[model samples]
Target: MDIGNRLKTVRQQAQLSQRELAKRSGVTNGFISQVEKNQVSPSIGSLKKLLDGLPMSLAEFFADAAESSSPVVYRLDDQPELGSADISYRLIGSHFPGRAISLLRETMAPGADTGPDLLSHAGQECGVVIQGRLRLTVGEQEFELGPGDGYYFDSTQAHRFVSIGEQELVLISANSPPTF
Candidate 1:
């Protein structure tokens, strides 16, 4: 993909000028201009910082780029798979235009975990356990949730999830600003 063009498209879709984006991203207007013009390549960290300013994740950016222009209905098989084999995340309504939230169907194999590093981002996340058991850790607190149990929290807090039961864990989750 043309990262420069993609960035420009997203930036325009968000209705942000390069100066505004630069200010939000803590980068220089010149840098943003150079990036949009394909005059320079940003390091991964730099690109991530830029994306963060858009309140977007790297995954979301890529997904948005690959998504169809407009899609209202998505079948199970049509959803894009993300993450790894142990913990699969299928995005729902991924092609919806101007989406304010991201919906996901997650399946976690027994002993599967999001990882040791907790996720912290710029939005809010909510999820409900559809089946099996989940161990959720937010900040310093931990909770073991079963089917029908739900959770809501600020995404800024470090959080992680793990499957605790022998059976596979299924969950439906949503996040504002569509992190992934």
Candidate 2:
């Protein structure tokens, strides 16, 4: 998928110039231009910052901002990916009307992480490490968890996830209020 095109369309729809978006998102205008041109790929956290500047949720940004029917049951292929080159976030029911939760099956490459910026959002987040190792940082506390481990916490607190060890990290996570 061309995430750069998606981002460009969204930014234009929001009536934001690259300079304005950069100012709002704390990124350089050059960076924004590079991303829009696909000359550079923003990390998940970087993209999140840009979306936050647009006052949009990652789910909303990726959902194409359309009103669509919500399926009662989602097939495996029904999930939409809201991820970057280094990570995979397969979001289920992304277009579900009245969605109150964000469910994602995530996979991170070895040494891949959510980027330098900490992620903060509304509601709560919980997840379980299904494969490999996970390094979860919430507030100033950090924990190294392995398969079968799970966590729950308020989403307002700053947090980020890192893939530890030499293998890919896979997890299933959910955020209330659909923060994505």
Candidate 3:
């Protein structure tokens, strides 16, 4: 998705200028320009702050970009792919309007990791391992979870996940306040 273009469109739809948004969001206009130009990828916190200026929630922003008609059921191949080369994240109910939760089927290749930097944001996350092993790190604690193991934690805390076993890791995970 072109987040920059989407943000620009949303801002224009709201009839707000870059300067105005920056003032309301308490960020520099340069930052807003960079984001809108796709020169930078804003952090989750930064994105939230930017959205706050428009008085829009993350869910609303995504919902607006989603398909107009939401379906009750999605076949296996119907789900949207949202991950990178090392990971396979297929979003469930991706077309659902005003979705409050993001349910995903996540597959991590062996030795795959979220990134070097920890992830922190609002809301909460939960996941259940369906296959292989995963190394989960939340804050300063870390644990190795096998099949059937589950985890739930506040998203505000820094967290990361890594596939530790030789085999790929497959899991079902959900995040409230949907971070696509």
Candidate 4:
């Protein structure tokens, strides 16, 4: 797929400049320019981060909106946005409105990390590692997990994720009040 062209189209549709998207995604403005110019191929994690800045999902980015016949539902909430490109999140219930929980199938590249800052938001989050290794940080505590391991924590506490092993990490995660 011509991802660069697609991103440019969506970004224009959203009425945002490259600088704006870079700021929102915690990426460099020059990187955004390179992506749009097809000069670089971003990793799955990087693409996920860019999509998150648009407040869009990987699924949404690739889906053909022309095929949809259903009405759109606009979500209203005062909660903060939470996510990391290090994990490509595949939302499971995009068609459902007023969903109380968000279910996702996440794939992280090897050595992927959730940037330099921890993330905190409303609600609770939990996930199980399905493959590879995961390094989870919650506030002052840190834990390393492998396949079949799981974790649950209050989302309000600062947390971060990192895929530590040589193989990509796969996780099934859920969040209450829909962190996305």
Off by over 4 Å in 2: 1-69
Per-residue lDDT of candidate 2, residues 78-142 (tens digit): 98888989899999888775567999999999999998999999899999999999999999999
Taking every candidate in turn, the Cα RMSD to the unseen true structure, in Å, is 10.2, 15.3, 12.7, 16.9
The C-alpha lDDT values of all candidates are 0.91, 0.89, 0.91, 0.83
Candidate 1 clashing pairs?
A: none
The residue ranges of model 3 lying beyond 4 angstroms of the native Cα positions read 1-69
Q: Sort all candidates by TM-score, best to worst.
A: 1, 3, 2, 4
Error of 2 at 171 (Å): 0.4
Clashes of each: 0, 0, 0, 0
CA lDDT for candidate 3 = 0.91
Candidate 4 regions exceeding 4 Å error are 1-86
Candidate 4: clashing pairs of residues: none
Question: The CA-based lDDT of model 2 is what?
Answer: 0.89
Which residue pairs in candidate 3 collide? none
Clash pairs, candidate 2, are none
User: What does candidate 3's lDDT look like per residue over 1-180, in tens digits?
Assistant: 667877897898788999999999999989999999999999889989999999999887777766534578899888999998999999998867547799999999999999999999999999999999999999999999999999999999999999997999999999999998
Better of 2 and 3 by TM-score: 3
Sequence-dependent TM-score of model 3: 0.62
What lDDT score goes with residue 59 in model 1?
Answer: 92
Per-residue lDDT over 8-96 for candidate 1, one digit per residue giving the tens place of the 0 to 100 score? 88898889999999999999989998998999998989999999899899999888887735667789887999877798899988767
Per-residue error for 57 in candidate 4, Å, reads 28
Residue 176 alpha-carbon offset, candidate 1, angstroms: 0.8
